[model samples]
Target chain A: MNELKELGEFGLIDLIKQDTINDHSSVVVGIGDDAAVLLPTPRQLQLLTTDMLVESVHFKLTTTTPWQLGYKAIAVNLSDIAAMGGVPRHAVVSLALPQSTPAEFVTNLYKGMKEICRAFGVNIVGGDTVSSPHGLVINVTVAGEVEPANLVCRSGARPGDVVAVTGNLGSSAAGLDLLTAGEWEDFDFAWPLVTAHLTPRPQVKLGPVLAAAGATSMDDISDGLASEAHEIAKASQVGIKLYAKQIPLAPELAEAAGQLNKQALDYALFGGEDFQLVFTMEPGNYEALLAAYLDLPVVKVGEVVDADEGVTLVDEDGQAQKLEARGFNHFRQEE
Target chain B: MNELKELGEFGLIDLIKQDTINDHSSVVVGIGDDAAVLLPTPRQLQLLTTDMLVESVHFKLTTTTPWQLGYKAIAVNLSDIAAMGGVPRHAVVSLALPQSTPAEFVTNLYKGMKEICRAFGVNIVGGDTVSSPHGLVINVTVAGEVEPANLVCRSGARPGDVVAVTGNLGSSAAGLDLLTAGEWEDFDFAWPLVTAHLTPRPQVKLGPVLAAAGATSMDDISDGLASEAHEIAKASQVGIKLYAKQIPLAPELAEAAGQLNKQALDYALFGGEDFQLVFTMEPGNYEALLAAYLDLPVVKVGEVVDADEGVTLVDEDGQAQKLEARGFNHFRQEE
Candidate 1:
């Protein structure tokens, strides 16, 4: 009987997360991942996913412009397609907003969305716009095409497949920390993290690169590395042993963590919204792929193992440890 | 800033209807229609769209059940596809709800959707469901395949193409009127109208049949016939002259209207939500189709004319008269 206002936006979102029951055969990556992929045909798989961002739930109206909100709403969906190792081709946007919503705001949102759409070569085909009973709700559905043979799922990693990550993690998480902590004085130091939180750069260009390099299984790390690794473990029916020393940490993130007196390793392992590619590679090809990936920095951080071992983390001193999933859980809180 | 609770659900929907703006391509039919279609495609094209009714907006938590909501939602969208000269094939559902939504409700909704899905043999291949800030939102996007050559649009009716309608109109509207008015005494009369309002049977099977018979253009009369007629006229660059006497009226509906002391003709013309195909036929084939359709009478009541004349209603005396678009205008009321 609690009113929605009592729960606020995040509380409502948390409540919603508990409702998802993913049991579809075609779902390669369901709810928790960046996007859900469904194979329609062998040659042409269709990826359909949607993300809705309420004005208050996802962003603050005082700080974020309508354009950024709109762009981010769309970018997040496109990121799902990228996570599925597919190219986004078409998008349909549906919006429910208050009548008082400024026309200029709507136009600018379209402009921001078109900027990204043009870059990704995706068409803004058709959609519906209606008045929202409450706040603005932007829902985007992106349809993508991928060859079944090239499609990657979280379940394909084998025992010997080397766990690797592209780019760094925790910057967005760090940015959120800074925002919540009121560390405005460090604006220069925290701007990247802030921007990372706002307009996430989904790695669409890197999907084919990883696939071409023969990634056994792959997924985007929207949740923290530890959480995503746990997912890969559960899906592939294998265990993962991550090397804490091997995690790439940006200097700014490390410093911020140091200032906050929180473990930077924890952030890198469990801070999500990175949208970086995480894949398992054959150990034999790891060295070559590693060498070839000089520019991309395919950091070998772990290896898949027997399920009996479960997923664990090894410290720099070679101490074996069990790693907790500290990433965002839609239904369950990390704390 | 009045709380949403004050407006309640229906009031909120009315608020939404008020702010919607249709600015893109020639919207042959817009917000109030079962499905909205656009022109400028290679050939005349029909687009069917529907959003699912969740526990809140279209249905009441205390009065309506989930299964009914789901069935009605899909039926609403199917009605759109039927409105067009398109055969339903694929559907994309976007669901938003809180996690607390009972699994039973979700499953029942799907069962309702699936039953309808199976009836039409439409594939529920792809959609996204996420936790909502409040209440459940199910948006269904249906893509029906139509031969580009024989495709019918709301705007293709020339002045000479007879304004003939299939089946009955105003029954659904009358049913809604009764439901809202709390007049539940006439079970026989009210049941059909109520059922018509809740689970509208879309004439999907007949779309192609009408098209193959050389229908000049077609549109589903989701809104009142007059509103849709205006759309067709504006799109086709023609005016419509309606013969009130010739407008098809079901005897039962007439009786119900008479008992209610409501203008039966007005309900037939302006009371919307009758998901019947109001199509035009070439004068030559009109008689043939009319004779062939014995089960559902196709009554010719009007003709399309040059857009300059606008829309006119001819009384029984053959005197041209002006008719207000008394049908639903989601935005006009607000403006």
Candidate 2:
């Protein structure tokens, strides 16, 4: 009886991977990647990814609408496709609901999912519905297509490449704080943060843009920046140096952080669920990519370094500190 | 606040489909089908489907091992691909487990899944693992491929088609009864029934055989025969006449039923989770198909009639009676 808490999430995943055998010749990339890559034809590669959102562990119906829950469910899965620089084409959703749930709530949930799927030109496919004795569970699987040449993986980063991110960070974490504190409506400035937590949008359109701009490596920022940076660093066998001042923080997050009496930078660095893109590219392509997304909010936050250098964060005073890979660990009791 | 019980499963599915819009040209078929059909390549059609098994609702951990649970989870999804007459290529599994669950339990679970995937040459590609506040949930999504010329849908049956079923029926339901009886170990003849309920094999090999033999309408029996029969009849706009005498029952099920003092015919008609293929083919093609599977157990149990005739069952005495679709309804309180 080895407790899951002793193994942790990553440890459990490693055990799962140990027994996984990729016997199919059509499998271009299998269990270790962000999305499973399959060569269905000579022309295109197919990407398959799945995500699960559990009640209480992922969300609470009291603070969130079924619509938001449904929207976020699909959005999170789409983020996986985006991480692999693929165009999401289809989605299948499986839901387990308590018998006490409302009929309209389920309908509204699908409406929310449909809204996101339609916005990205993805089609809702087949699904299974079953009754849960307790709690609500949503599992979404997204299938996408990518050209082999344009596909980006987390392992492609090289030393001296610049690390960049799309949109702002810490807003979702800040929003989650606001939701936890209650009375969020009293502070009108905190509404955006709250909405960011409830309905964080996946950066689907930005994936192909970065891939076309010669971005070497990319991953979605579902976990904190430090955690995701460690993933890219470990996968690419490179070190990363993040500049604290350069990390993008939403203005609303600053106000909310102030109201909560916390440092905004801490949230920007460690708060996750932003669903934004983090990527590395050659120094020369950084400016060109920035120029291309001039209308969008993109920023260079760091640079990839030699593997021996390790991952670190540089403060405003030029002090370098090791970046601890701390994020939400599902099996960590302390969390 | 309409209760889910009021909507039922089909009503809820209808609501879900109302807002679903297919936006991708590659999506040949989306929601409302047994599996979503996609033209991933011009050469092969892709079939995608998903199924979820939740704690207590789908299985009892006390009576079943994590390995059996995992095996059955993937097997059920493979059954969906079989229903569409496709060869499963890849699978992604997502699990939500409680922190208290044993790490070894999770490992053994994946081991079970790996065994089945390896046997079928299906790749266990990618998955997500997260902590649930309570209970264990497993969701499996399978992607399969089929040639357009060999594809089979649930709507292809017409009048004069013979309805046939592969393998034994009602054994799983009888197995469940034996499991609940607490002294199942005392009866050596009941071992097969118990194993059938614990690890029901999916009919993957038989699907292509039927499709190659010109089978028209086909579905895997997840719901009871009555419910699945209604599905094919409704989809094909035809009536089904099931012959009670022709329903194949395993000898062990008869012994178990005698011990339980219940009618074996009732379980044969309404018991579910058999994972056997129920299909219809032109009367001319039926004989050849049966001859092809002569070494295997196949039975011709019914025939398709005009839509106006409705679905019915002819008892041993040749009296026709309306077949009630009293299968497992997730939201039905009576279930």
Candidate 3:
């Protein structure tokens, strides 16, 4: 959760996206696709999203290898496209490196990027490599295609929709916690958390299916669940209340959190960079649309409500507390 | 020239772009758009290019205003599209700002970007903003379109092609000089150089014209005329010799260079950040395709030759000297 304070990754996206950029006719959606979708032509819709990763702030070289760094950079962008019900096609990388960086590190970074791109059937098309005076800076832009009907946006969650997630969350955040603490001596217990943090699998396949199945809204949970739920609420003009007990957390992350004297719910709610998809759909639509795809580990965590109710979370005690867009503190309401 | 030594920008693009990326069916061009072109489909070719600008390395806030920084960021990406003979339609910005950065800076930056986007008929479609631990980093990915037949690439320069530039050179480099040195007492002489450095216009219109005119090879003169010439020669399997007297220099830049006690040719040869298009086409093709578009200020400054002749430059004295991919040195041959 402290990393959320330090990183400040997507916290300001909503504020920045509100600033008016030119509205062109070719643009089907602008800033508030806020998934960052840009469809050039109606017939040939291309989903475009970009993410910039800063060294030390977003990552540290001591813990993240150049290879993993490259892999995650692509993964984040791909996650955005998938959340929009699109298939990423090409990636253009803007890599700024210090002059002193070893040649081998860059090679490995691209290898990692290419490996992921190969898995997703995406091409590494064009890129610019410049010398940075400071730490490494990577900005990746992924271009994808989506059918107009299958396209999803953040501004579609409605009252009475089921608040659901595609997979277990917090493992990535727990993994990050484990990596930074480096106090977990048992390889057997700590390996999953470390791997999850290092290389979080994006729910690429489920996104389009969800859109086709008519999910009301979707978001790639890059900035923790509470922050993402806030974005969806603000965009959709609705309210979301997630259930603490219902929020799915991997057994590995839960076990590690217990050993580390941390709450798993804290990691799920506030720990960012969990690339799992959090979405909403009408409860009645699930039987025909998602029943066949039940193997996706899709779990209902809560329900949507009127905007007046506000985005809140129901703790185990049945107390609903308002969630701050900032760090999650269960006792923040008391404070 | 000192800034060139300090900034080391784009010096290693070739080595990095040379690394193998996946070859996919949809990727009409990969690493070597090396202007970074990605044609999604054969019929619907999309030229993709990305550039990352880092503080101190690319621009200093002390010298570049947020507005100018934003304008130049889009300008650089637009220039890449122009160089490829494509019409830029969309841009995705990845802006990393320090937590201390004022909200006003971000607004003005977007205002500048939007103003330029409006001018060029481009849209600011998507963006991601994150807190940077260090200096501001702006990465822009421009998506453009071109007829596959009219597309220009670095490897298209053939022997006997006339090497031409869209406009006067060295103004941008000279402008950077005036900004950093701050020794320019005369605003009349120094203003153009500073303006050129801060807000050099991209040759967006000329790119498609030159490509349509059957330009054999092309590249944005970003790194410098010498560095760009080497890329063309290396890609096209040809030699290029730029004529010093023929390389167009604006009177404003020439006067400023003289006042600073520096040679204009040095700025033209090695000073980077000029967004003009440097292209090549045969003399026979020029009269028919370009004669009508003569007002574009297209100047022939060099000639492509057999590869064994090498990428070189003819000094004013008629001394043919090899041009290094690195910084320029007139007396480098003397050593």
Over the stretch A165-274, how does candidate 2's per-residue lDDT look in tens digits? 99899999889988988999988889889898999999899887888889899989888899889989987999999999899888887789999999898887788798
Each model's Cα RMSD: 11.2, 11.4, 11.1
Model 3, span A53-97: residue lDDT tens: 888867889888888888899999889888888777777777777
Off-target runs (Cα >4 Å) in candidate 2 are A1-42, B1-42
Q: What is the TM-score of chain B alone in each candidate?
A: 0.78, 0.87, 0.84
Which is better, 1 or 2, measured by TM-score? Answer: 2
lDDT for predicted candidate 1 compared with the true structure: 0.65
Report how closely model 1 matches the true complex, as a DockQ value: 0.08
The ten-residue window of minimal lDDT in model 1 chain A covers A28-37
Candidate 1: stretches off by over 4 Å: A1-43, A182-186, A258-261, A283-294, A323-326, A331-335, B1-57, B183-187, B249-262, B285-301, B322-335
CAPRI-wise, candidate 1 is incorrect
Residue B126, model 2: lDDT of 60
Model-by-model DockQ, in order: 0.08, 0.19, 0.18
**Alpha-carbon local distance difference test for all models:** 0.65, 0.78, 0.75
The model with the greater lDDT, 1 or 2, is 2
Say which prediction, candidate 1 or candidate 3, comes out ahead on lDDT.
3
Name the 10 consecutive residues with the lowest summed lDDT in model 3 chain A: A29-38
